[model samples]
Target: MATTDSDTTTTDDTVLSMENVTAGYGNTTVLHDVNVAIEDGQIACLIGPNGSGKSTLMKSIYGFADVKAGSVHFRGQEITGRSPQANLKNGISYVLQDASVFPNTSVHENTLMGGYVFEDDEKAAQRAEVLYDEFPILGDIRQQDAGTLSGGQRRLLELARALMVDPDVMLLDEPSIGLEPRFIDDVFERIEQLNDLGTTILLVEQNAEKGLSVADRGFVLASGEIKFTGTGTELLNDEQVGRLYLGG
Candidate 1:
């Protein structure tokens, strides 16, 4: 699917939506009345500075963090504050920032872990091999322990593991974090490829410029609220966004 002209204006097919969600930690409020929509097979990027509640919002959607109010609907089903297991069952895969894979586990083991929702080992191994094909590097490193892989490789491994579940929407938290410049481009390119293949990606990125550049739509979140929303091109050309995020 092609990208839309406006960020806030979603395409005809919307896959996931957050309606007036207000969530936070135990006592501190982070997201306030946040709203965003992702169309089927489109890459939707969320950009903001640190502490802007980007990851917090994602965590709330996945039931990792407490959702104080509002609802997150995926494929038109209410999923707000649903258990992590339930979310995974609903085909929503979340790739956390802190490398959720077991450091001591082998790449194949981490990939197989995504099969928590699947009971059959044969089916799990088959899905893992498919993902390994998608991420060729994982194919050769399948026997290697995840801890020994480089930063970029581990991040790619995370994505492969996420795919093992065949999710409808993949929640990626700061995918480009700790990646070198070349690997960053590769990562975003693969994101586009995934979107092309009918995956809805909700990506949180610190490098707003690169994020929006490859995204179909972009949302600028500041202090937990959406300040600006537009097409990737619109956000790229905006003088303020350029001045702040694009190194103007």
Candidate 2:
């Protein structure tokens, strides 16, 4: 969907919008009127201190949290509190902070799970082939059980599986978690490569410097409310973000 100056969907500008959203877990409120705008093919990040509700917001968007108020609009349509399956059908995919793959399953089977939503088996196979080429490690490990792979390898497999859907918007929770320093850098590089290929990304990062570094726009959530929103460079330069989150 090509976007215009006025259109809020697809034209490479603000494809996702959350307006006055109030959502939470059972009896535990997490987000309070949280609002944000993510543009098309943009790498948008959320960074904050612990207990800031960054994960809560990500879960809400992915339909894991209960939305009590407000609306979530994607591609200019209301999707507030939609089911997880519904969100996936609408071109949204989520990769959680931890290893979300079936560790006991072979890498190929794990990846095949990603294409289960497709109706045509042949098309699914073709999609898997394309992703296998894009992520050759997955191809090599197609017969290997995911449980035996290292953390970084598993992380890569998880990402490749997410791309199996060819999602328009990808939500990532702490893609750098628990990775060795070398692999951590590689992970961020892979994320940048994805963004360069026109995949929209919404990321939650514990490493504020790295998060704000690669992102086009960054948001700060403190106490379940957005404290700041700006370009990655601007966020890195901001005194408040630097002092509080980035520890600069």
Candidate 3:
């Protein structure tokens, strides 16, 4: 299948979108004329080689990167250049690629941190409890120090914490990165479960095949530009995409 520009077209169902966005850090642009839209209740995957601005794109959406041009919209409202704090308050949660837990904090406490935007402490605690019900393993170790968790446990903790806000959109940067094969599958399963529960997700994944396997839509980006866009299966089966990005 050949790449098309239709992925940039936003529709009534579009929950998150970037139009002609040029973003990067401190005047050093990493993305160029990027256009992508994620529909409501869909799992969209962005796959590219290292240094291809995948993480930058995630940051751009979450207000971590500077959008030098164009606009970003969420639920039809413009949010270009919004602060990270504001973005979180507006129901956008980001799970970073790097370690993000407090080493000395208890597991339950870390989970509560996700609801920092909540005006009441009790509500945050209640939200954490609800998340624990969805992630029983975290509930079982609520008292353990975050530093003591395994890699997979830490990843799950990150996911649960991010959900503290009950976000409408989740920007997951390399969710399965650095995990063992066993843990990787578990993380992906959790991602699917989240999508099933009504959270629209935009994921930047290193494992091209596995990422697209679960994605409802897929985008291929390179050198700070979008190169392809289609249904997950369409991109996965594309001869060029397979030979280049998928290592076929």
Residue clash pairs of candidate 2? 2-11, 3-11, 14-39
Best by TM-score: 3
lDDT (0 to 1) per candidate: 0.84, 0.85, 0.94
- Collision pairs in model 1: 7-230, 7-231
TM-score of each: 0.93, 0.93, 0.98
Worst 10-residue lDDT window, candidate 2: 1-10
In terms of lDDT, which candidate is stronger, 2 or 3?
A: 3
For candidate 1, write residues 1-248 as lDDT tens digits: 22222334334587888877889989989998888888888888888788889999899889988888878888777888899999998899999988677889899999999887897899999999889888988899899999999888988888888888898899999999888999998888888888888889999988888888888878888888887777788888888877765677
lDDT of candidate 3 over 1-102, digit per residue (tens): 546655469999999999999999996999999999999999999999999999999999988999999999999999999999999999999999998999
lDDT of 1 at 206: 85
User: Better model by TM-score, 1 or 3?
Assistant: 3
Model 1: lDDT equals 0.84
TM-score of 3: 0.98
In model 3, the worst 10-residue window by lDDT is 1-10
Model 3: lDDT equals 0.94
